[model samples]
Structures are given as C-alpha cells and as structure tokens.
Target: MDEHSTAAESINPKHQALIDRLSTRRSATTTSSDTARPVADFLSSFASSKLSIEQSLSESRSRADLDHISSLDLDQSSFDSASSSLLPRKKFSFRNKPQKKEEDPKNVAEISVEPSAIDKISSLSVRDGPGFRNEKDTTLVKDFRQCDVGQGEFTLSDLENCRVYLKGTVRALFFYRIRNCQVFTGPVLGSVLIEDVSDSLFVLASHQIRIHHAKATDFFLRVRSRPIIEDSNRVRFAPYRLTYEGIEDELKESGLGEETGNWANVDDFKWLRAVQSPNWSLIPEEEWLEIADISQCK
Candidate 1:
C-alpha cells in the first residue's frame, strides 16, 4: 500500500481517467470488432459499417474468379470459338454500290445516309465495343446489369432464326443481315441502324432509327426522334413493347425514360411524298403483342 499508493498519487486524476478510457476502447475494438467477423452478418456494427478498399478488392477478385471458374463450358466444342465472338473483332463485308471511283471497296458501313448531331458517335471505335457476332440458331441474352457501356456501340450481325435479347442501355445499336429472328432490346441512347433485315420482329427504343433494305418485318418502337427507313418495306410499327427487371432504371439513365409516341412517325427516305408511305403501316391494336416480358427469358 505504501509503494502502490505513492505511485498512483503521482498520476493526475484527469490523466488516469484518460488512460482508463483508452485501455477500454483498445480492448473493445480488438476483442469485438478487429478480429473474426461473420461474412453475412450485416447488422449495424463497426465490422459492417466500414470496409477497407483492399478488403473490398480482394473480395471482388475472389468472387470474379469463382464466377469465371463456374461458367466454364466443359462440353463446348471447338466450333463454339469459331462461331460466336465479340462483334467489333469480326469482319463484316458489306459491298457498297460503287457509285464513284474514289470510294474504297472495303464496304465501310454503319453511319446513316443523312448525318445528324449523332454523327460524332462515329469516333467510337467499333473494335472497342461489346457485341455478339457470327451467331445463329441459338438463344442470345445480354443483361446489362452492371452498366458496362458508356455511349458505346453494340452490334448484332449474321444472325438467323434466333431469339436474341439485349436488356440494357447502349449509345448505338446495329443490326445487320438478321433474318427470321425475334430481336428484343433495351434503349439505344443514341441511334439504331438496321440493314438487310427481313421476316423478323424487332422491339426497340432509341433516339433515332434508320432501316435500310429491310422487308416484311415488324417493328415495335419508342423513338425520341422521327425514325427513317431508306429502303425498307412492309414493316409494321407499334409502341415499344419490351420489359425486364431493372429496365426502368436503365431507360431513365439512357434518356429514354418516357414514351414519345414517335414509333409511327416513320419517315421513308425513298418515299418523300404527300401520301403515306406504303412501305410501313401501323399494326392494329388487336395484333399488337403484350408488353413483352423478357425478364423470364434469360
């Protein structure tokens, strides 16, 4: 008591109180929070409230590795690699009309005939875009859940007799040589280009649309601007009829939050007359499909 009381009295009361508070906090943190934590325990607690960036990145990389490993197709044949690939890398050979001697024969395609404000989007490199190319007779589904594209172009080409679903937002969409297929997609924030399509059904939303050399097809659309058809015919138009989970958020993000009733306002570039263009007609309400629910398709 003599030695202990002498040492205790040497420390000030305020300093002793601070020392006790610090000891309690360090003990509580180390024992209750800094140690083992339940991965799924999301209750309001220090462990759940703040996560370190290194820990978050480590978890993300681990989850990605697991997903990649789980999605590996063990039964995929060698032909699978040759048949389907990202669009930008594939070569699309569309022969131009060769009107003049100066035009290169490489068939440089995609920008519409009469350019507009969106022509600047041409700077988006096709090779850098994400898409599906050289696929046929198979079901294709793309759910843009993570918002991977930013004013990026997407393409679907050389497809036939397939049910394709694209649910998300994109800057531009291109459909080339699609036949006897049913294409359902989300909002094209910029423009949609369709070339050489026939006997197909398309439900799309876009700011602008251009169809060339299409025949006997049906279109359900929501357009912010007048849609143009260069050489298309027998196409029917109706209101856009495609839906999926989280689509409202995607549409809102892409500036297609509201229906503009412009699907029927199609302008035929070839038919500039006072009379209605015979190439396109309105689909009777009786024949119009229900708002297609692609949420279950995938």
Candidate 2:
C-alpha cells in the first residue's frame, strides 16, 4: 500500500480511455483474420483444378503427334509418295473393243440345151389355182410285172415316183394319146414334159433329172381312166457305148443310138427321154435288156 497505492493514486482518466481504444482494435483484427483464412483456402483449391485440366489437354496433343510420325515407312519412296501425297491422281481404262464386218457371195455356172429342148412346159397339175384336178386314172403295177420295153431286170419297187431323163422329140402323135386320156397337166408340166409313146402304156418323158446326179425316173399311170398309181425306177443309161442286146437293141430300133448315149449331147440341145413302165421287158420296144451305164443313169 505504501508505493503501489501511491502509483495507482497517480493514474489519469485519459490513460484509461487510451487502453479501451487499443482493446477494440485488437477484437476487430481477430474477426478479419477469421474471414480471410476461408476465402484464401477456396481460391487455392480452384487454381489446382484449373492446372489439372490444362495438363491433361497438353498430354493428349503430344500423344497424337507421336502417333502420326511413327506410322510412316520413309524407306520406300513409292510408298511414302502414296502416303504423303497432298493431291492424288485418279486413273481410268476401257475394255471390249468393237468388231469388224463380213463379206458377200458370188455366182456359179450355166446349163446347155437345144432350142426344142428349152421349150416351156406345156401343161401340168397345179396346187395353187383352179385347174386343181386329181389323177384321172390310177393303176397299180405289182412286182415282176413285165413292161413293154425289153429293158433289163427291173422291179416295180423301182418305179414308184422315180425321176427320169429322155433325149427325144415329143411328137404330135404322143399328144393325141395323152390328151385322149384323163391325165392332169399344169404344175407338173412346169417342171417336166411327156413325149412320144414307147408302148400303149409307157412313153418318152423328161423330169428333173441329171445323169451326173443319177436321179431316178418317174411316171404316172391311170386306173379307171384316172391317175391312181405313180411309177418310179432306178436305171443306168450308157447310150454312148450301148450294145444291142435285148432292151438296148429295142432302144436302138426306136431311133435312139449308142452314140447318142442315154443323154443326147446334140449341141446346146441335150435331148433326153423319160420312160415309165411296170415291166419294160414285156413291151416289144422295151424288152428286158441291160442298158449300160446304169450307175450313171439319171
């Protein structure tokens, strides 16, 4: 109480006021520090997150650059050119060319004949127009039926629709017999002609025949005055070297000659005679005798 009491007694009111002011300042500083610590912690956490995002983007770009550089094979110039070429050229090609053209055809030869031999067909049966008439008579010739001619052995089987060639004149006398018969003529005559009669039933004829081609002989006969049967025959005629035997002898007597051959080469007039028969041997003019060159007979 002696010294301390004496100092306390000496304190002023202004000093007390200064002490209170210092106390309020200290309280304010403590509150400001508490608020600043939370704000600073929030700013630091935001900066760390931004730095992580940037690092991830930088790593991704670097990897892409490395991958591009590693894929190239720089040793091969052609391969490198194909890979690194900025502008590429596109190629194109075509196939299957067109073809060329062809050629044409030509002509051949002519035939020989006489003025009379070249005569047009007088009459025949036609299938197209009105004159369409059937055969007036039809006659069947059996096997071994003897024809009027003395031609060598011939079969009736050989006489059905055969073609023949004759080299002789078709006289008016023959037409008299043919016209009297109910025989049809027109289209048939267009391709052939009937000439002089060799017998009562058989006669001289010419059909589409050629000795070179050896075409058979053909003839039509009548039954009941109407054509009912067609005769045909395979014959070889060698008139050039014909020797008078039986049929050949009769043929010679009938004004046909060995020199004339089966076909008469009379200048352009190649006269031919087509004959039909069941049996040529039965006929006096055509007795069964061998006519030479049967192989060449048309």
Candidate 3:
C-alpha cells in the first residue's frame, strides 16, 4: 500500500510541473501592453471582417459541414457550375439613361416601299417613348410643360381617329400612320417627321418639317424653313394658331417664338414645276381656326 501511494504522488508532481510550464507559455503569448495595442487592434479588425464575411456567405448559400472533414473531395467542374450563378451583374439606372433599342436603317421612309412593310410592321414592336402609340379611337393628352421636355424626343405612331395634345417644347418629334386625328403641340427644338398620315389636322412649330405619303391633311405651322413633302397630295397649310399657358416661354427657348411666315413656302418633291405646286396650298384666312386655347385642355 505504501509503494503504490508514493508512485501516485510522484506522478502527480510531474503532471503539475508540466501544467505550470504550459500556463507560463500561454501568458507570455497574450498581448495587453500599450506598446502592443496596434497588434491587438489589427487582430480585432481582422476577426471582425472575417466574421462579417462568414455571415454573408452563410446567409447567401448553405455550406457543407466541415467539422468532420479530414480530406478534400471537391469536384472542379461542379464547383465552377454552382458558383457561376452567384456572380455580379452590370449596373443600370433607367431614370437617368433610358434603354434604347437598335433602330433599323431600313425603316427609313426614303429607302423603303410602303407596300412591302406589312410583315415588318408586325415586327416593329413599338418601343415606348415620351408620347402615345398603337391606339384606336382614343383621346391622348401629354402635358410635358412641367418636365425637362427639351432633353427627350417624342413619338406618336399607329394612331387612328384620336385627338392628341402635346404641350411644351421638345428636342424632336416623330409621327407615323396617323389617320383622322387632330394633333396640336408646342415648339419642337429640332425637326419633325411625319409619314403615312391622312385626313388629319396638325398645329405645330418646329425648326424643320418633312412629310411623306400624306393625303387630304391640313397643317398650321410656325416654322423656321420651308416644309418638304413627298408622295403627298391635297394637303393645305395655314399659319400656326396654337396657344397655351407658358407657350411663349417654351417657344422662345426653342427659337420659334415669332411667326416665321415660311409655312407658305411649300416644296413638293413630286412637283418640280415653276408654277405653284398643286399638291399643297395655303388655306384662306377665313377658313383658319381661331387661336387654339389649349391652356384649359389638361
């Protein structure tokens, strides 16, 4: 019994000495002094970043438990395939920059025949701009007087038997396939393009005007230059009669504030004679509409 007791006491003292040595090593490795503060801060920040990264990864996707893992068993192709969907995407903001579709050059009126466009018209897939489109028997009014209207273009297409009121100056304007419509607008800073219009009345002010394939239409224009026409007949022109609140300011800013009298100078590509073109004629003053009061339109 004494021999066993002595052996146990000796074994305990050796174990105790080894424990003291390990505790001394641990204490020496700990950092607390002011001189070691930078090291402590660096370690703390590194730990915080690592924790945040781990939390983000865990929230996004589940990971396999690695606690019992003793060897790597990753499949390279599977890893790539799984991670590909987690990649970042390109940045976009539609408010600042609108998405613009590619404009087909063949869609230009001068280059293409109208009869061959039935198949292409279905594929045109009208892109939404600042104006109305694809309407039948509807009344549409766009009051852009409160917008930065000069920065963007307006489009009106495929409309039939409609009344359109466009208020405020714009960068440019486009009209296509309009029929039996009464259209009025403020000044256009750039040019105006019209195509395939019939039996309509237009009151507009613009820097330039071009008409194509129009029939039995009437125009009241405050223009900077002579208007041109192609494949159009029985069209009549009159002085601009549009008026609205703040329209003078809008027109002044677009450089069309005053009457230019160029509306009477009509140029028809189909009529190249020295005599006046029979296609378009100036409307008599008696038939002119009274000053259009569109202020109360909205």
The prediction achieving the highest lDDT against the true structure is 3
Give the true-structure RMSD of model 1: 36.1
Candidate 1 lDDT over residue span 95-133, tens digit each = 774555665435444333446523433322333357777
**TM-scores vs. true structure, each candidate:** 0.56, 0.20, 0.58
Q: Which residue window of length 10 is worst by lDDT in model 1?
A: 36-45
Clashes of each: 0, 66, 0
lDDT of each: 0.71, 0.27, 0.75
**lDDT tens digits, residue span 197-281, model 2:** 1222222222221111111322221111111111212322211222212434333443432232223221112223454332221
Candidate 3 contains a number of clashing pairs equal to 0
Alpha carbon deviation, residue 190, candidate 1 (Å): 0.7
Pick the winner on TM-score between candidates 2 and 3: 3
Clashes in predicted model 1: 0
Model 3 agreement with the true structure over 99-205: per-residue lDDT tens digits: 68877777876556665544443345444676788898988888776775555898999899999998877888899889999999988989999888899999999
User: Candidate 1 regions off by >4 Å?
Assistant: 1-128, 147-151
| Candidates sorted by TM-score, best first | 3, 1, 2
Residue pairs whose backbone atoms clash in candidate 3: none
